[model samples]
Structure formats: structure tokens, C-alpha cells
Target: MSDRTFTLDDLRRILLESAGAEEGVDLYADISDTGFEELGYESLALLEAGGRIEREFGVSLDDVNLSDITTPRALVEAVNELLSVDTAAA
Candidate 1:
């Protein structure tokens, strides 16, 4: 497992890098509860972001249903949970 704790900043960076933020979207704002669709991120974009997260963080997201993770906060929580599990295992 990676020694990195996934944060909102990390998610923002990955989302922007992977799929580019929407034109009018303020990714820096408090978007924890904002839905991805509201933020102009489609399912495809989120999939790409998930892939990037898996690669960058050395965690597997195979068990996570991206569709269920509608908000950035949920995604961050999920990734952190995986990271915590990895930490426990280590």
C-alpha cells in the first residue's frame, strides 16, 4: 500500500488531470456533497478518475461501485477506507 492518504486535494488534482473540470465548475469550493453530474463529471470521467486513483494510490477499486459513489466526499471516504484497511493489514 502507498503511504499516502487520499484527500480532496488529491481527488481534485486527479479529476482535473484525468478528465478536465467543467467550464464553470469551481472545483476548489466545498464540493464534498455535490454530485458528480452537477459538477459536469459524467460516469466516464469518474471511471477514468477511479482508474487513476487505483494506479496512483496502489489500491484496488474493483469492489467499489462507482455509480454508488455520487459525491466527492463519498469517493474520498471510500478511498481513505481502503487506505486504512491497507494500513491495518500492513
Candidate 2:
């Protein structure tokens, strides 16, 4: 896999443009880390977060399990595939 880099800002843009969301709603708000955990962000919050992720990564979250995303990194990897991330691999 080729080393790729993308900023959180890129994600924010996609979230707003594609998912029609604002940064005001943050799932990783109080969490120290972004990962899937019952103790962490709730499913709804996770879904919302996933929406931003899918938008940012240009991926589809329809069939993907909610639990599949436990962290930002995992989310990126999974989404990269759907997005056809050439800068990075999923």
C-alpha cells in the first residue's frame, strides 16, 4: 500500500458537502480516541460520524456494519475502499 495523507479538514469539507452535516455535531467530541465501542460514542452518534466519514472518504456505508468502525483510522481504511482512494489504500 502506498503511504497517503489526508487532513481532518478534508473530512469536514466532505461531511458538509456530501453528507449535509455541520461540524457542530461531533461524535469524537469528548472521546480521547475515535473507535467503535458501546462505552464510547453511541450508535446514532456513530452513524452520524460514519456519515461524515463516508462523505469524506467517498464511500458507501449502507451495508457496512456500525460496529465495523471503532476508530478514525479503521473508518478511513474501510471507507478508502469504497471511495477508491488512490492516494491511500483501504
Candidate 3:
């Protein structure tokens, strides 16, 4: 398994950097269960954030179904799962 783990904080930062935090949206708060749409992030913003995550984490997200990952927690879990697979393959 990979030593690296994708946390909420990391996702928050990347989402902020990729598309910026929405006004009145407290990204610092516990948003793991919050949907991206509820957080004011559109599909484009999410795609951008996913791109950033892929590049930074050195993992391919093409196999994962983005439509199913509607929350920060889901995204983080997907990324970490991919990281674990990568480590196992290596």
C-alpha cells in the first residue's frame, strides 16, 4: 500500500487552487459529506480539480467514474485507492 493518503485538507487546497473557494462557502469546515454542487462547484471546476489531483498525485483517474464521486470524501477515497493500487503494482 502507498504511504501517501489523500485527506480532506489536501482536497480543499487543490479545489481552492484549481477553481477557488466559493463565496460564503467555508471550505475549512467539515465538507466531506457535502456535495460539490452544494458547495458551488460546477462540473468544470470539478474536472479541473481532478486534473490537478491526477498530476500532483501521479495517478490516472480515467478508470474511475467521475459522475459517482459527488463529494469530497468520495474523491479523496478514489484518489487514495488509486494510489494504493499504484504502490501495489510497483
Best by lDDT: 1
How would the candidate models be sorted by TM-score, starting from the highest? Answer: 1, 3, 2
* Estimated TM-score for each candidate: 0.96, 0.47, 0.94
What is the C-alpha lDDT profile of model 3 across 20-61, one tens digit per residue? 988999999989999999999988898899999988888888
In model 2, which residue pairs have backbone atoms overlapping below 3 Å?
34-71, 35-70, 35-71, 36-70
Candidate 3 — what's its lDDT?
Answer: 0.91
lDDT of 1 by residue, 1-90 (tens): 556799999999999999998998999999999999999999999999999999999999999999999999999999999999998888
RMSD of 2: 6.2
Give the TM-score (vs. native) of candidate 1.
0.96
Stretches of candidate 3 above 4 Å error?
Answer: none
Query: Which parts of model 1 have CA positions greater than 4 angstroms off?
Result: none
All candidates' lDDT scores? Answer: 0.96, 0.54, 0.91
Q: RMSD for each model, in Å, please?
A: 0.8, 6.2, 1.3
For model 1, give the 10-residue run with minimal summed lDDT: 1-10
Of the pair 1 and 3, which is ahead by TM-score? Answer: 1
